[model samples]
Target: MKKIKTNVLRLLDQQHINYETREYEYDDNHLSGEHIVHQVDLEADEIYKTLVLHDHHEYLVCCIPVMEEIDLKKLAKASGHKSVEMLHQKDLLSLTGYMRGGCSPIGMKKKFPTYFQEDILLLDRVAISAGKRGLQVILKPQDLIQYVNGQCVDVIR
Candidate 1:
């Protein structure tokens, strides 16, 4: 496997955040977060999916379990907006510098308000993307929240 230097890894290292990298075979058809949990040999509850959402005017980042779905009404309440929608897939790369399946909450073109499913705090460690398909960064959930200034909210259904 070739080494991939992702911005997410750099930021974590700079902050002295302890983490482990888990890489699996890349397959678009089998790369959902649920599948990643199995591929990486981790629990589904400990792996998360990063979603970019828009309330029409601004974007917010939401992290939820791969096996769960975000309730838009809850997301709207969390964002203090009337409605919340997932950002268009077409706009992902240009706006956040991440492709659809490889978006990590940590290293983006700019920082936006971020939210994590409150359930993350229950786990000692959580697995997120390494800013690339087929790679995961496993680290303390507390470290991630502190590093990203993320809010913990109950927006997942």
Candidate 2:
């Protein structure tokens, strides 16, 4: 199978950021919290998913552990917005150039403000979407913060 061009990888290369990529069989509709854990052979808590949300006026990106759900109110306050609502799938696609299952914190069409759960920093390494289904990137938390200019906050409940 041909490799999908991921902005994450491109950005990493452009900035000389180090990362490791792993690929599995493409599943197309594999966005469930459990699938990623199995694919990466890691505990559910060690993997994270990115959610694209809009506070009506601006877009924000929230990264939280796969095992947890984001508290919209908390996320909104953390992002400095009055309210937070999930972005539609179409909007997510148009804005990030990635489907729901493949949204990466790095390399988006635009740099939306990013909030990451503070607990994620405790992990030595974590797995995040590599811009496509069946693809994942393993990197250190610090590397991700530096690469994406993410703010560590209590965005998850």
Please tell me which predicted candidate would have the highest lDDT against the true structure.
1
lDDT of 1 by residue, 1-157 (tens): 6877689999999989999999978788875666777688999999899999998799999999889999999988987889989999999998899998889999989999999999999998999989998888999999999888999999987
When superposed on Cα atoms, how far off is each prediction in RMSD?
Answer: 1.2, 1.9
Cα displacement (Å) at residue 144, model 2 = 0.8
Residue 74 shift from truth in candidate 2, angstroms? 0.6
- What TM-score fits each model? 0.96, 0.91
Instruction: Give the per-residue Cα lDDT of candidate 2 at 130.
Output: 88
- Point out where model 2 deviates above 4 Å: 1-5, 26-30
Clashes of each: 0, 0
Estimate, for each residue in 1-157, the C-alpha lDDT of model 2 and write its tens digit: 6766577888777877677877756665765787667766777777889999997889989899987999999988888889989999878888988887888888888998888999988998888888887788888889898778899998776
